[model samples]
Target: LLGDVKAAGTEVREEYRWTQERWDEYRRLAEEMEEAEPSAKGLIFLDYGKQTLTSDGRILNEYRFAGKVLTQDTKWWGTRAWYIDEGINRIDVLYARSISPDGTVHEYSPDDITFSEPTRGEVFFGQGTAMSLTIPAVDIGSIVEYGYIDEEYAPEDPELFQPRFFFQSGEPAKLSKCEFEVPAGRELFYETFLLDANDPYIGQTIKELPKFVGTPEPVITRTDSSTIYTWELRDVEPLIWESNSMGYTTIAPSVHAGLYPDYSYYHERFGRLHREHIKITPEIDSLARAIVGDLESEKEKIAEIYHWVQRNIRYISVKGALASRFGGHYAQITLDNKYGDCSDKAILFSALLEVVGIRSYPIIVMTNDAGFMDRSRFPFWGGNHAINEVWWDGERHVLDATGNLHRFPTYSMGDCDLYYANYVRGEIVYNPPIPAENNSMQSVTLVELRADGSAIISDSMWFTGDMEAGYRGYFEYMPEQRHEMIVEQFVSQRKAGGRLSDFALANIRDISKPFLMEFSYEVDDYTIEAGNYLLLEVPALRYSFPEIELSDPNFGKKSDMTFMRTHDVTFTLADNYTVRFVPERFELSNEYFDYVANYEVDGNTIRFTDRYRVKKLRIPISDYAEYKADAEKIMAYVKERIFLSEE
Candidate 1:
């Protein structure tokens, strides 16, 4: 085929630019190969990138580890297969350490295959870069299993993982190149499928490998003419289930088990060094003074600094291998360079705030990577983000410097709180924004019907600290895309029973000082059939706790838990209305607890009121079940109460 193509086409033809008809033929052949055989078990291959031994030989071997599995009975392979080209010029050293349920480490050789050899062999077309990865297995696990594949990827390598042969990098690839063998007694059902790659170079590609019964099997194939350095893999499932997936899960509505910092020597050193060397210069002082002039409120001053950094800095995600080198140090250089990741922006904001009278702490937050932050282990190697915590007027405010356009009133709390394990490092650690200080508030829909068959309703909300920070992140950072996302989210949640006729945001206001967000939207043309009325439930609308509780079954009682969120809403009925379901006013009255809910009606407007406070800093997991149940109960009450009537 290579000779035929070369002879048929002009020698001047570009590399990889095959004719359309020829490309289609190649794809067809690849498809046939893909539909090969059934390999029963799962196989993971490790090809750790190259390593150079130093003169002193200071353990460079331990430095280039790739992929961390969080499950049991995981089998991996390598052998000479780790060599990319088999020419001996480019080779990878593979090593693996599996952890037992009891935390015992077992090292394995490359030749071992504990389970059935599911997918094996690489197809070299006698020449070139085109290739494919195949996985053949049987239906055995749940769809929700957490599977992740992180290969040794470095962008500096020119030929590193470029998209070819119908694969688009970064996007989801749908390839059916393998067959699933159904065991005699086992059932077959696949609920969900997911493919993800953080690197942008490799195009996402998916080809279906047909499943045929008996001896005929499937294969994954690819043909590339270019010889480039990169890493690629096809993962079909997670190493462990979500329940056992380690790290921080959610952040906004304050959860107890946020991501804990890993207790590694490097982490401890980074924490200590960060805490020690975090500093601001006098030049920042002059700059801040010039900008603020005479802002009286500490909040305003802090907000100005936050806005300045966010506005001045641009977001550039340092991904892949370079992140490890670019992440630490160079905060000021990033500021000077005017481009940085989230942490760099945060550092600049903290520095600027320090220049003024307002004190700020440089906090580390866990992004999706590195799992959750473990507070119990204070110095856990946790978190992949850097944010700021500003203290003002006896209260601490969370500041995210990434989105400068969203300073003050427009705060963002979206996924920022999902797995927030934050700590104040350096001289500014006086009172960093703790999980306890976060709060979210939202009003529920209290729709009352009138005699004329029209409905009346109202809504209100408030947020503080981390919740405000989240809102700020969303409102300010992503102004262009915010309203659209908000509309979609609202429509999806509220328009469950009735078809969404329309939604419109009204009464827009920016109250940055107290950091409050207020907006109203109308859901029009909503109808409930007689005897089967419409019930619009209020989503748990806090940054964290209002939606779900941070408690566990093993831990019976709630922690020194903090409750913080407040809301108000009114619904105006059309006419001749009557109350159908009215929630009972409830209050939890323990020093450690802070909560209240009530409803009232005046004229045509029905008002729903709520309040919450935080008194404790930490909540134990032992009491999570009760807390979760209580939260559900409250949510049910709020959802159940709906004013109904007929014309």
Candidate 2:
């Protein structure tokens, strides 16, 4: 079937296989497309996708598209396809041709297709190639349509299959469809998620579905020995990007289909495969020993090895069949290359820990805004990142080696409060939330009010846990000169005419200690003078939370609002001035969060200390009004000022 499809085209090319002539032609066509259509950079008219799965273990996937080239931006619409390693999957161009505005057809031949390594951005290990060709005669107002078939053979797990269908894209699609077919007796399950609750479903399926509720249950159907499912949506408007969104997968209407029976079955199978790839060799043992030499404690040894990989190995992104999708390279390959993607780094790091007699496993996780996994919905393929989980002192410590600038023992920010599937343990788990103390920022600011209203300010800050990781990363790659400039700019922003005098940083490289930064600057006309009184506006020494307006129509319409942070600041006055007034001490506590602030005057110095804690990671949308009221009280307290007068 795959061969017949390839033969239907004028030329058939193997996946990722391209000639030099074809490469030149691709480049030439890109230039031509750019010159002809500049505004059409993001124009995509039609995208049709299909996938066919057979009970015998053969999967064929194909994508077809036709769109106008309005500007250079639309050049990306040219032909491109990615496939796993040929050893595991075979890809062929069934047909690729373009129609000009004049209705002339230009058919591409297999000899004209080119193959090369897919670009890896910040990934270290990659295994697979890309086949791409820019359709000829692609000009303004011209319509181009091309498609290819990617057939994957999974003899090892013939019953394993999972497919996701996205109903929306960056550009509005005039028409789109998702089709799947499986041989008889192969049970099929599916669930559909709609971004907006108000959007209606327009797609059709052979099997009658019950009224859509929350994520509809899978509709099972079959004709004789084969089961076929089809969903079609037309005139889908582009998804509007939202700030702090959970990503397209969560926001767009889509369907997830799988053939596995349960989560444990999928977990155990994938875990076994991952374990096979992380076998520790003699070289790995020796290297681990060298890296952790004389490190007495288990914690120290783990930190040493984790930091070693982060500091030594560079991260490069590789999107291919094995490394990008289902499998990863061996530990030895990643160690020798000194570069690997998240999975490669995780595998090598896990192996190194194993050699040192430490129990560790590579776990799959979704980073950033990929959203959380639904354990109830078993056999779902959702995680896009891999990290290591080490068992030490009867506790599990989650570590991500990809954070090159992060300190050990501290998982990346936002990593907590999410679901993860442990490959070694063969179970799904939630990462423990970082304690408020662990994710804290402490700062002391000294303010000297001069007789002339000019003042000098010095600040000392200490960051720990995830907070430390963020600053450490910033300082690790930033140059000394740039650091100085950034400090100057920071001070200037707060004190309109502030001039940086001295700056120093400590404990940046010492991961065991909290990261510290100290800087002093002088601000001209820092205080307003009226008669014998000095008006001193308190400077915000730490990050402030943005105001949440409960009045907004869409406020709390989607996910909950959750964050944790602590900031402490102190201010002092010169001996020449006596403090006359200060904001009263106050405390606010609620189910979702708590804020405690106090102010005191000791001789010529006034100290202000406040602590804010978010008790719940997510506050239900229904609780937005209450959350906003509590947050507003904190904002009001921060706005308080102090008054001083010369004796």
TM-scores for every candidate against the unseen true structure: 0.50, 0.77
How would you encode candidate 1's per-residue C-alpha lDDT over 1-647 as one tens digit per residue? 22221232222224322234533443443243334312223222222222212222111111122222212322221111221221212212222233332333343322221212224234112211221211122122201111112222222321111111111111111221222222133222211111222211111111121121211111322223211212233322212212212222211001011012233433444445444334565665577787677898887787666667766777765432322222334456655667666766666666677677777765655542333333332333345566666678887666677654453633443224233433443222222223433554444554544454443333334455555545555655556556666745654565443323334442233434445433333344344545646443333434234323322222112122243666655566665555566567877644345568887766656676777665543233433445566656555555463545554
lDDT of 2 by residue, 1-647 (tens): 32433354554446423345543443455455445434324444446677778756788787766565555655566656564564557666655666555556667765555667766555434566665566666666555567776777653455566777887665555556677778887766776666234423212110112222233333345788688777766555555444433445555667777876667666767788789889889999999999999887899999999888987877865545543355456889878878777888898899999988898888887764565445455456447788888989988878888766566676675666677888667777877555566566667787777666678889888776667777876886688678888778878887898999999888766665567888999987887776677767766533344435334322122223333454445566667788888889878888767777787889887777777766545444455566677777788777767778876
**What are the Cα lDDT values of the candidates?**
0.40, 0.66
Best by TM-score: 2
Worst 10 residues of 1 by lDDT: 250-259
In lDDT terms, how accurate is model 2?
0.66
